[model samples]
Target: MTPDLIILADTIHTMDDPPLAGPEDSQHVQAVAISGGVIAAVGTRQDAGQWQEADTQVVDLGSATLTPGLVDGHIHPVFGLDLTIGADLSSASSLDEVLALLQAEGRHDDGWLRGWGLNPNAFGTVPLHRSVLDRVTGDQPAFIRLFDGHSALANSRALELAGIHGRLEFDQASEVVCDADGVPTGLLLEAAAMELVQRHIPQESFAQRKARLGELLRDFARSGLTGGHIMDHSEESADLFHALEAEGELPLRLRAAPWCMPGSDEESWKELARSIGTGGRRWSIEAIKLFVDGTVDNGTAWLYEPDVRGESTAPFWPRPEEYSAAVRYFASRGIPTATHAIGDAGVDHVLTALESLRHEVPADVLRRTVHRIEHIETVPDDLVARFQGSGVVASMQPTHCTHYSLADHTDNWSTRLGPERADRAWRCRDLRDAGVTLAIGSDWPIAPFEPLPIMADARLRRRSGKPDQHPIAPSQALTARQALEGYTSHAAKAAGLWDISGSITVGKRADFTAFELDPLTTSPDEFAASSVLGTFVDGQIQFMLERHA
Candidate 1:
């Protein structure tokens, strides 16, 4: 039978092999043929040639590798794009540099200035307070987000606009850092606190957001991403994403989760659930997002003991039982829940809650409502054992450790957790060994959006080229194939789309990520430096780096 398209590559990792190196090594298949948006055959080049006909289009991927389309298990597309609108403080090395960046960006016509990706380590021994930000912004309302997305720094004007003066009540571990005099210092920890200033900041229009999202999707495709499981969904996002899907031919697939905060009323929960109707072939909204605790960098992670700074250690949901009830509330309705649980205490709370629901919900219901925990940053052996066959996914980002922390355990995150807990950083290998499903992601605009670098980091656990670059917890590093699975098969399982996507097998959707070199056998440095030659979705080329360039 004739095929619609044929691709010949040096290697093809079908992800269907029995725990082998790659498909080329296991099955000796060098070519794949597609028809009607599904894989028709996967065999040798000769086999593919035999299926060629008058209309068959053949693509020669010289020395390139073809694998299942990459999937970022967790990302924030709309929010990431929104962050790109202002000056990027990600590269600032010191507090003065951060102020210099804000001064360069200056005030906007709205009398507000915005910046994202501020690394807390830049402050060094200095405390992150409004006094520093006020130096540059003066009267302008300046709001900057830390690289971790768990905290923010707002100038005094922005704080006043948010009406935050002294202490406040919050369901989560959110806090407005106050001075010795009980006055806010312009530092907001966690979503609840950050939202105070975030809500007051000028928001982008729906049309502007749509345009930015379109650009972001194109960027995703170029980076070899064909699917992204978005963490949070805004009302504007729901409208724009559905509109994009309706327009047909999305560059990539999106499985979004509408946020479910801690303070919403029960009726509001139902309203939020009803708001997520259904999506088309390229998108879906079938999950809800929640945060159990904040991050360790800002001393918000719910650790069993206090951080080195002796800061408040509390769960995002003040009442543990209330959060447990909320999880079951949504799970009973057949909706999956993804919770952000970073510290060991936070991970324990989530696992205990899921265990409690084991008896209440039926087998099928529980399986359908597979819960996921994002960024299990620090977990003990006992808590890790709880996820074995528990149907909970460990959605992790390896770059978080590589980019944010150092091997010497002196990074802000490590110093906060202290030597003991910090040594447990991202247990990727342990989770996989315990039979827990692992789904990897970039958490973009926070780290990087590219999958290759993230995959390499997961495998190598250290930066490339610099011999002095130490490996942060090398014992936790994942194998190359295991890291690949984090972005392919396991990522699909994380989003509950394994049947239709994930693997490059016959009768499955023809979504593929093409690299200029065989990523499986390539050196970590080379793979990290490699470019994505092409990204195909449903047998159609959505992005070709050369053509676009």
Candidate 2:
């Protein structure tokens, strides 16, 4: 009974626990034996005797903490890694700084030039209009996506390209902001802005995109992420993944969910579904993605009340009826729906739609589908009970609290939501108590994709920078063990791969993350700053941090 590989560590955390009234129990194992890319044994050195063989490759990770590889349940990986090449205005503290950065980057002769990460609330004033961007961009089609990715600021050149001078003929949920003189403001909110920007940004070739994606996947391995869920996949992205798999360039496990638009034809969706069959040993395509609303930063998150500034109740999906139809259609066809809902109104609409679908459809079909509400921020207290045993998963990001903490106007979120609703923000513990399965992720480009920051925030209930700025109810904060499980087993279960890749059981895949510090005992600050020592997928070392001895 010789194993192919054996990894010995100082500590190991296997996330196995039912919902507890308190913290989960952590188990320590001295070694793990792997055979045929699967865990053969998890025990002390003596227990490993049964599986030890002469040819077994033993990797002694002297003092590292070993656990199941982290799974990022939601991320825009393709765009995240490309930010370094574009106009990175994420750290621009003021309008002048943003303009200066753009000017320094120089102008492109091509009609389209893009930048991202500009928050109007961070400046404490209304963003400048197209005229301001035009002054600096000088007729180049410039589109700056807000940090939340729900809105964009477009220059006059971009607007002209989109044929929207000032007033835009948009559908129900999209808006074109205009100044008093009927001129297009550079700021385009929600779907309208996205539509305008989409018209100008030229699409990349499949080869180029795949190369960039492969680079990013390797980067993930270096960060100790052995597997992740692609939140938004297009046909081009799927093709890139398959090509990598065929070429043996895919180093990490991939679970992709193709984007499903609100009004997509049923036949078209079914065809797309048929195209994505069951995944192999390293990749999967078992989910569908939908968006119910935009982000709260750009005033597009379909809020129940007006934003604190009294702007407006944010827009929902363009065609609510059509969106619901799409959800029903996906569910009827056996594809689980993972809908993005950031605002209270968006959450309410999705819940109502799901209930309606359940009433109309057969109970067995409804029960089998893995309907998820992504980013359920600002949830109402009364609705907490509805999630229990309802078969809906909550995929939430913990780093948003840190990002939004820097916002200027917390008054609206604080007042409209009040202290009660604010306490429920990313309510992991409450949802767990209510019998809801929880999964964790970093929205990637929205925040750093590192799992340490997420784990720290989840456990400490606040960013490591400030002590007094805890966003949610501290009681709702998850224990370190629960948070880790949310990123691993719970995430795998959400993606319907629990039996194969979540834990270090005998039959599961040998995917593990080696951390420099013991996540369970490390201080929140240290954990947030700790580095990944290495990552292994299917018993193969994909990334090993070079030790500077």
Candidate 3:
């Protein structure tokens, strides 16, 4: 049978179990042939020639290293369209910089001042309040999403517009933080609280967002991502993915998980279950996303002990038992779950919940089910051990540790937890050594979405391209091989898609990422700077580094 497409590179990682063939340093397979969007042949260049016909489209990426396409274990492409609108404050380090950028952005003086990715460190000693931002915007009615995405800081005008006065109640662990005197501080914690002000802001048209998402996915492909596990799915997400796929081939294959929040009951769970597996060619809803707790920075995370601020002592679900039931309910029907559990107690609860299903389900069902804990930010030795021999995949963002916290125990994340817990940082190496499946991701809009830097940061234990910065728990660093596997092999294991994708085995889907240098052999710093030669999804070229008109 003639192959429809042939991809020939100098090196291929394969990332398979015994790796099919090739030494550890280089050369797994020099060429791969695809027929009907699946790998038909994987062998040397000479072998590829035998399978190709005259009409076979061949791409020769000379000197480039090909591997199973990189997939982000967690991302929020749909939700990010709204979060990333207005000013991009991701690079603004200080309050002065944030204000300067916001002032320039909202110079129009009439519209709402919006921003996303505002680092909590920018507040420094000052508390996060409207007064600080009110200084700049006056009455511009600003609503800025913090770097954590769990919280937002709104200006006085914006709060007034939302009719937020003093405090409000929410079924979830959400709070409209107020001062001792019963005045809204403009610090909204968790989703319910933030939506108060967010609803007042102007929204973009569906068509506008659809166009932007298409552009974003192509950018993700150019940055060497052939797939993503989207953690959050909106009501319009399926429509958006369908629209983009109808236009042409989607650059990245996306798997979305819609949230099952606290206020939801069994009926709500049933609704989500019915919506599962509804998608187009390149996208599908295969899993459910739930939150066990909010972030550590906002004092909403479900920590074993309160931070220095006397916060993070509660779970997002007011009734912790219901969270477990939600997991079990979905797991029984054979759907996987990816829950956001950052704090130690949150991690403990999720682990305990997964363990409860052992007797109910058969050993085979238990073995096959893939329930992951997203953002296992900090945990003691015992909890880390629970993941070993247990099917609970640890979905982590290495950049969260590398970019957010400081080694000195002074940053918000570290300062709150104090020295002992702070000493335990990300623990990527700890989990890997324990035989846990660790899938790496950017948790984009919260962190940068580039997979190269995320991979580099996993090994570096500090921000890539900023060697001058000290590593946050240097001992927790993963090896070059472990870091790459987190994005490929382990990521596939996390989503239970290891059989069909993840690696370049024959009969697997023809998804691949080509980089200028071999990811495994290249130095961490140099690898982070790799120019992606191209990204291919299902035997179709998403984009090429160099395009000829």
Which residue runs does candidate 2 get wrong by more than 4 Å?
A: 18-28, 79-85, 109-112, 202-207, 278-281, 309-315, 406-424, 465-473
Candidate with better TM-score, 2 vs 3: 3
lDDT of 3 by residue, 1-549 (tens): 678999999988888864554333235478999999999988888888788899999999878889989999999999988789879888888888998999888743338888888999987888999998899988688989998999999999999899999888899999999999999999999899999888877788789899999999988998999999999887788788888888887888899999999978999999999878888888899899999999889999889999999999999999999999998898888888999999999999999999988867667766777999999889999999888988789999999998889988888999999899989888899999998889999998789999999999998998989989999989889998788898898889998989998888889999899999888889899999978889888899887898453
**Model 2 compared with the native: what TM-score?**
0.90
The best candidate by lDDT is 3
Model 1: residues with Cα > 4 Å off, grouped in runs: 20-27, 246-248, 275-277, 547-549
Alpha-carbon runs more than 4 Å astray in model 3: 21-28, 107-110, 547-549
Q: Please write out the lDDT profile of model 2 over residues 178-241, one tens digit for every residue.
A: 8889887868776545676675667667787788888878887887788888777655565666
Give the distance in Å from residue 514's predicted Cα in candidate 3 to where it truly belongs: 0.4
Every candidate's CA RMSD: 2.2, 3.2, 1.7
| Count of clashes, each model | 1, 1, 0
Native-vs-model 1 lDDT? 0.85
Better of 1 and 3 by lDDT: 3
